[model samples]
Target: MDLIQRLDSRDADFASQLSRLLAFEAEQDESIDRAAADILADVRRRGNAALIEYTNRFDRMTAASIDDLEIPRADWHAALAALPTAQRNALEAAAERVRIYHERQRSETWTYTEADGTMLGQQITPLDRVGLYVPGGKAAYPSSVLMNAIPAKVAGVAELIMVTPTPDGTRNPIVLAAAAIAGVDRVFAVGGAQAVGALAYGTETLAAVDKIVGPGNAYVAAAKRRVFGTVGIDMIAGPSEILIICDGKTPADWIAMDLFSQAEHDELAQSILLCPDAGFLEDVRAAIERLLPTMPRADILRVSLANRGALILVRDLQEACDIANHIAPEHLEISTEAPEVWAARIRHAGAIFMGRFSSEALGDYCAGPNHVLPTSRTARFSSPLGVYDFQKRSSLIQVSQAGAQTLGRIAAELAYGEGLQAHAASAEFRLDKP
Candidate 1:
């Protein structure tokens, strides 16, 4: 069986074939949706009692009350203290870098006054509270905790609540240490659709948050979709993706491992390579076959590479850049002599790794950039999760008496054109008499 699909851009059906490859339908599973709907409704109605029941059943915990499920600040500090020096230092260093990067992204309120004494501008304010959902148990991600929480903290969110499942009542100290380092205000041992529900709708124990951010499983994603109007949520992400535009000069082994890094994420994750050198493509393929066996997650890597991965032969670097704009992959790597030269051609991509040395893995953890990126071609319109995701903007307008006379006439004319009689009258009322 072929390990990865090979395509040539010169083929007549290349466009359609590439579309077919990129197409991924996130069809809602009936069973998962029904389960999430039932759980959300039950939690909304029963509040804390429902949280306790679901936590016990889903996470294998024996918690009898909400208080029992809450991990206090002291516990977070203890987890940080308990971590080995190396791990703790890494977590703190990563958190500080993330914080500093997001601090530059923080938007400030601004206003401007005109000669007529009219004021207009934007007022940027932090959300009152935010909820971050982290995958727990064997998939515990301390990096995820740092990536999601530090940006919200830097945006000046007043309170940040985190929820992660602790199956069998076993907690992950590294995650807690990250929470402590990121300044998460509260931690709860709950997960799945129930936890999303509890955060969307105020429960007896957990107050409802203004927005929810972070990644989760299918059920959690569905719950966030259903409760979007009730509370704002980060984008519903798809499988991880990486597209490398190599000039065929980088070592084949290096490019091969770069593809595997994203493929190892899951069987559905995608990794594609585009280059002009047919010989280099073969070299990378050989490297993949040679090195794949040594990976710990070789099974997953093989499935992913065979299922969604590809190696395409383009005419040149320009053709590669044009095709990349169409795919708009979640992570793009330009591995060439002058990466910046090709990078400037890329208009669409969630994140771009400038050169061969800038691995996507670095951006995922400690590159001082948010790793929570738009996926599944959403990069065409969306962006990476950052401080802006945790902040709200309000348009400020204070019209002076003289300014109102001038603006009212224009507003009334548009309102009348739209057949909104009340709107027209309201604007006309502020106009000065002739």
Candidate 2:
């Protein structure tokens, strides 16, 4: 809590600790694959029978028939009527924003012709259907509902099937309300790997989906990993994380609380602070020490911080930015004087919050961008779920005889070099006609 201890180098083992902490990427037991394979096989083999059994076993509720799996139209209306006007209005406003942002991400089919009359372009098509999994425990994120569904809607997907688990076999009114608001085509009372299996393989009740997108617990994540080849998945996301770069301008209390917001997600969640000023570092550390005792999830934050979180004292803001690129956190907050400058320098992150005023929570709910982000350094390559995830692209190419001959020689040679006689012959035969 004191300045001296806050600035002390006692815990200088950040590198070794980070190596161990990030190793959680492989924490899921190998048995998860086996279990998922069994569930997938059952669903593929038994269809509705497997779904009902898994629902009873995993969700603790029995679905007597396929009809029992679908949420009634009456329930959707009731869930809407149950919400307070203010919350309903809030969801509407958020949905509008989400729609506007994603509409821009939408793609259009295009074609172009060359001088030789060769036509080549791209054909963009929305998936016929998609499956979105919404987490039913702890909290109901209507924002996630908007984030996942709006993109599919904008991408022109015909059917948007959604699955969520209910412990009491009773759906959350708010979640149902959000589903209706997002215009979801179907709602199923299934959760866990079973729900994923149902979506991936298609039971008599649920149709197979082209892609599955959403967030879930360890079991769900493991199932997604196992069923990857069977169906497309958004990403194998890990625990939430937030890394902030600050200077003396921002208050220590604010920084401490911001970090804790992400840390409270779970013990493995990471909250890091990278700053140049040694004095400001100590102040923020003091704030963390002072505030930790009062937080309800203090124990969780403590473990999260001790494990993957840190108050790293970099030499300068440039160094802070460099280190951030190396880690590629899920969320990056720049609280320095010129946050925009720092944010522009950021090459990788699932989401970026610039300036002291723009809190990370803003993006979580009200902000238009999807909150389903890449985690565990996956931001280095992947992006958050969006309209693109709901859409597919195919290259379009056409060739006149002249154009075919012009390009075929190179193609044939490349194929021959790779010792693919069939491939070389296929191209050569077209050219040989002339």
Candidate 3:
């Protein structure tokens, strides 16, 4: 599974080639869209009754009552005690790092008063309620619990509700323990589009949330898109992706392993390398060939590399930087002499790894930054979930007698230009002269 093309040779159609390379993300999963829409519509129209029916049908869990939706406190404690001491400690440590990082991101409300008696400021407030979805069963992610809930906690969101899919309507001990560590206020055993629906539109047991976050399958993403207006969503995340930029100094095995990290996620996952040296690219390819056979997800990795992965040879480091900025991968690893020098040029990316030592796995678990990020080139326009995601900002303005007179004239003029007579009249009335 290898792709090699000289940068100069593709110059004539480079734009279209780049466009095509980045365009795979535009291919929507209509099946997921249709399925999620049906579930959302049903839940919106019928409320808990529809939610229960769909959960039973899809999740195969008979949640007869709203009480069945939430995991009990006793269960949570039992799960925490059940984990091995080392794993529990790791979770605790990860939680601490996550909380500390987000604490710095916390915002405060402020007000400013001018000499002219005009007051202007910004008010920062946390959402009253939020919903976090943690994938369960084989896809259970304890790290996601820390990434999603800690930010809301730092932002001071009052009620942080967590929902995870359970094949048998049972919660995972690790997930429960992680949620507890992360300070998730509530736990529910509901997943997929239906869980998202329950959060967007309140069910009897699960209260409606101001925002929904965490990663999910294609169906889950589609559900978030559908319920966007009903409740807030972090982003419509796509398949995971990673790009490694090296200058031939790094070990081929290390580079190959990093590519495999994201490749094992899914067949659609992309792992690309942008390097100026063709010889190094061949070494990385040889490493992949030798190593791919030993990995457990070889089938998935092979398909991912063959279809989504590529190793493009550029003319120089500048060309590599240009291509990386255009791709804007979710995880970009710059393995170079001065990674920081190239890092400053990167204007867009979800999360950037600075050196060879900073692997994608580091960012996934213990790194200070959030692992939940925009995928499939969405990094160009979106950002990772952070303290800001859980907080809302309000513009503050106050007008004194003189300040109103000073500003109302311009306001009236703009309103009049838009043919909003009532708007103009309202501003004029505030500054009306006797």
Best by lDDT: 1
Query: Where does candidate 3 clash, by residue pair?
Result: none
Question: Each model's number of backbone clashes?
Answer: 0, 0, 0
lDDT of each: 0.94, 0.84, 0.85
Which is the better candidate, 2 or 3, if ranked by lDDT? 3
Model 1, residue pairs in steric clash: none
Candidate 2 local lDDT, 1-434, one digit each (tens):
22112222235775565465456555667687678777777888998888888887777786788788788867877898889999999988888888998899999999999999999999999999899999885468778788899999999999999898877586788888989989899998888888888899897767899889888877788888878987899888778999898876898999989988999899778888888788888888788889999999878888887776777777778878887887898999999887888888999899999899888988888789888898888899989888888888999988988888988899999999999999989888888553
* Whole-model alpha-carbon lDDT for candidate 1: 0.94
Candidate 3 lDDT: 0.85
Candidate order by TM-score, decreasing, is 1, 3, 2
Off by over 4 Å in 3: 1-16, 25-31, 432-434
TM-score computed on alpha carbons, candidate 3: 0.94
How well is each residue in 379-411 modelled by candidate 3, as lDDT tens digits?
888888899999999999998878888788999
Candidate 1 lDDT, 353-375, residue by residue in tens: 99879988899999899999999
